[model samples]
Target: LQQFLNASKTIDEFPNIPESSKSLLKKYLTKDVYKKLKDAKDANGFTLQQLISSGLANPDSSIGVYAGSTDSYKVFAPLLNQIISDYHQYDVNSKHTSSWDISSYNFEEFNSKHKGDYVLSTRVRIARNLSKFPLGTNITKEQRQQIENLAIQAFNSFEGELKGTYYPLGKLTEQEKKQLKEDHFLFKEGDRFLKACGCERDWPDARGIFINPSKTFLVWVNEEDQFRIISMQNGGDLKQVFERLAKAHEIINKVAQFSITENLGAITTCPTNLGTGMRASVHVKLPLLSSDEKIFKQIASKHHLDIRGIDGEHSESKGGIFDVSNKRRLGYSEAQLALDMYNGVNELIEVEKQLK
Candidate 1:
């Protein structure tokens, strides 16, 4: 049924991007990866089905390609551009000097203060992977357990406001699981798309949530990505959230090693999340922007933003609220990512007021 729905039912076997779908790769300009494609003998570890399906669904996607493993570098290098762009944007060729800092940004003076009933809430989520481990798509069951074990050690090490409890999905009741998901506090079951790619196997195997005592900061282990570190609040206090995440990131890394590239910064299952792996977002009420989607989209594009429904990723908006977040993550610092959205949301709110 899933294949029938994806138009992949006619083909039997592991999904590959296929010859016809290679055209999807032409949109982005990549350096090292493309040069190697001419001499490369095989698809490395990637299946054609895994490469193009997501983009086939949304061609306008900024980064259309994916790598199932570190070997994916041999399979697809175009994503290497994520690192190049990051280095070029920041002029940092070494990870030693490059840094992730939220100290320079203050959301209070700008967007958060003027939120004025227009802003609902702000969130910052960072996607990270355990070093030397295959991405979620290609990780073994034991590897998943290993990640869970590492996470338990790390979460236990958290101190002060960051300390929390680990709730393994395999132990949770159906009601508890459903509630976490509905609250957007936990990830849903693996999607059919991910299942096809071998990302979701042995359901409820090692998946779980770790929320701090305050519940304002949490991490999702073995979800869409290995680790989705999140800090959020009821209103737009982005400074507090960013600072908390920065401290938590510092503490978590002591126990968990994230896949980091000297040039790429931090590597993730998704190419777009390469550098920062951070998606700082705001749930905003945009009645005026909703009324003029074309203009709204143009403004969002100008601000380098991606807009989603209030319910998130493919769900429809309720009461004119949308999730707007930074679209370019591969080439900037974490602070810059948040800053872009802070300034952009301010611009959006200004437009919303004028429309009234």
Candidate 2:
């Protein structure tokens, strides 16, 4: 519960988890996992045990294992859709024609104080590891190929990429330029300017010249194209800043929308989440509780379902209720995933009808 509260607080304050944690967990987990877990708990009936037992809880193991499970994937999908939708809406609200101009706030100061560099650095490392040809060098050729396949599997496990385009200022002295280059920091320059500066790295093939009005500051990833006349003093509200960029995109495109679907039904699963897979189910003492434990166990076993005592592995409070909900899968539409969940539940219901 405390963990859930902390996660909720973080969402209220920023886009998602701090970038540092996102980088460290990227290989094992995705931003979607955090979003799912954060949104799993409800105002009624669910307990911590239910979450753990259902395999929807965030465990101490490599996030990779948890995310690899189909159960976790189901829980993450809806949340990812919501995040994308929200980002789109924020964009719509920040356009030039919109009543507000969020660019008047200072974003660089907020980023520096909040450890944005550490987060981006970690992501760069993850990308470097992923782009390698041979996944692990020590093994045989066949094993190396297998590892490479596994890396591709890992990348496919994520729904999308975290992208940003950074541009540093032009007034830096010779020593500053050298440090920036050596540090792998992003800088701005035209072809002629870069060639004259004698920097060893080639310019990024993008068409635009990178420049920031502020002499030595960073801008949000979504805001790079605006190129407005706002100062750093105008950028503190993070939501407002993101909204500005989102609005710009909406204006350029001329159409925008945000929508999400919630699956509020029971779902079945593999051995891991048998009785409570995709649904936000809560274990309760039904009126039929204690009526026929043996019969219930036998029925469940026959159909490959799980039967737990009142205090099941997924239950947090002894004899209290357990609640479990969906964890989304990356790369699939919510409707397709929902149909899968519904079909599983339908099978279980058919089994129950047979027993009756």
Candidate 3:
């Protein structure tokens, strides 16, 4: 209770919160709300402290909060629901249905069109958690290794294109680490946001990456979430990338159950990723379109797209290349979100062509 009071006091002082902080924790967490939820604890003994520790420690976190367990949703619905509705623009009363159907995603037009003029590479990835385990924030070291073992079994079960090797982070050689970082396939250690939330407790002990022979498909095990399945390749073949991801999603589901709900679609640690937990992106050159930040953002917003730097979020664009991706994750199907990026990128290219 005293800890809650101190944290609330700091939150009450607006000056203490950084001006650049846009997290929901900083936005919706008022003294009154904190006081109301202070003594509350979920059935699993997950406390409100565990939920907001990350946000409190990293004031600049965009979302600033996480779920220690799936039960955290029901236990902390008041704050979490508000954040979800605000970020995802989801109606709390409405149901969230997931659709991974790629049958109709046959983008014949895109297949024939030469997108190499502007598009460098296409990538699609989704965040998923195992239904039987607690999230990274609350998972024990033993549980984390167990998750890794399960992933190993799943990877071994793969036959055709999905067959791959698992490289544990703890065992990575200096050269291997450099190679992974250079290829942008590595998740670095010591993220302040992740650390504050207790996700970094076991460090790289049970963490690893599973990549197939082609290197186009990969999965990050025991990161912020249980799994971050991804598919990528050169050029702007969104359909191909998404199709691969969908197939992997299907295969993984056969090995383990993902934490999911009719109201949330895919349950994740962060509220912003609660629904689809998917991000379909392209690192493309949009020199003219991106020159004017305001116009670039306006056009992106019109198509429900988000623009990020070439090195990913918070980084700067390089050599006229920018990361363009779907902004909406909730209240939409997996295929719908992929289509949103496909159509949105096409629109962006058109706008770019018209620009000086």
Candidate 4:
């Protein structure tokens, strides 16, 4: 069973294996093993199907198929066990690096039906640090290796769990099967499969990639292209990655600000900052902070700048307060616009102090 599960890494590799089994096998095997299994052939010189039918139906075995007299369970259990074991191993090895904490890893599991088969799908999150590289620079050998390692590890862990389960028989009840059918797990002519990570979207055939249960905030990595999709849920990491990429690509920075009023006629309670709102923030490329305390306070008082600490006020109520990003205005670069916002505020405050 272990060998069978490990034989195919991709869905296309094992056509004879039920979709359910393929999904489970994917969950258990390491990326390396999964790739090998994907490329492996059955022992009998026949396909995986022929080998399974010959030996799986022994009566004394604990693993038996409920639907039919097949020994499907015996063929699948070892793969599942291997997958579970691999997960634990990863969990243990991953703990040593503060950067690779499980807290940064997010996952979701669900089931999908294709044709007459049921498939279990999962999404996992991974944290990658990219601050070391400057924008637009070619990836160094070290960086390339790091990215490859992450991709291989992720795929292996997924493959392990996938190999463990018997094909197409996820612990679903008869009622659940009926419900799933009603919910359209069965493949449709126009069904599409779409996956997005970070800012990239994959709509190969828009009609072919339908969302079974749509997921918004998850990371997906595709080894074929060596690209990833990062959801908004992990904005901190996403932002860092974006910044790094921008530097490497020589992309200019841009800034945009939100205001309470769109026009001068709009009335606001915050008298001092009525025109601009209580917040006056700029996204700067230099990564500078207000160092002169006296100047900072004077400006705050004059403009009614509610200088917020790292934990912004919106966080307490909305949860992801810090995730809100500055708007991007075209034409003007980010660094130039940020300088204008901060310097303009400082200039206004200085003028106000002089008049007083």
Give lDDT tens digits, candidate 3, residues 1-356: 34334323322232245667898888887776777677767655667777888887888788889897788888788788889999988996688878878677665334346333778889999999998888888787899999999999888888788888999998999789888876767776678788777788768899999999888999999998999999988877787788888889988889988998888888998887888899999887888887788888887887899888877767788988889999999999988998888888887777777774
Off by over 4 Å in 2: 1-327
Listed in order, each prediction's TM-score against the native is 0.81, 0.19, 0.92, 0.17
- Pick the winner on TM-score between candidates 1 and 2: 1
Which candidate has the top score in lDDT?
Answer: 3
Write model 2 residue lDDT over 1-356, tens digit each, in one string: 34334223323211332334322233323445554464453232222222222122222211211111223324443432233223222221222111223233332322244322111110000001111221111112343334334423332332212122233233445686567444323333332211221111212221111223332222211111111111111322233323333333223222211111133111111112111121111232222322445654454444333333233223242332221112332223323333332233233333334544
Candidates by TM-score, descending order: 3, 1, 2, 4
Q: What does the lDDT read for residue 299 in candidate 1?
A: 84
RMSD of 2: 24.3
Candidate 2: residue 178 Cα off by (Å): 57
lDDT of 1 by residue, 39-126 (tens): 3322234443454445544444444555566556435554344433542344334452235676666468434366477767778899
Better of 1 and 4 by TM-score: 1
Provide the RMSD of all predictions against the true structure, rounded to 1 decimal.
5.3, 24.3, 3.3, 26.8
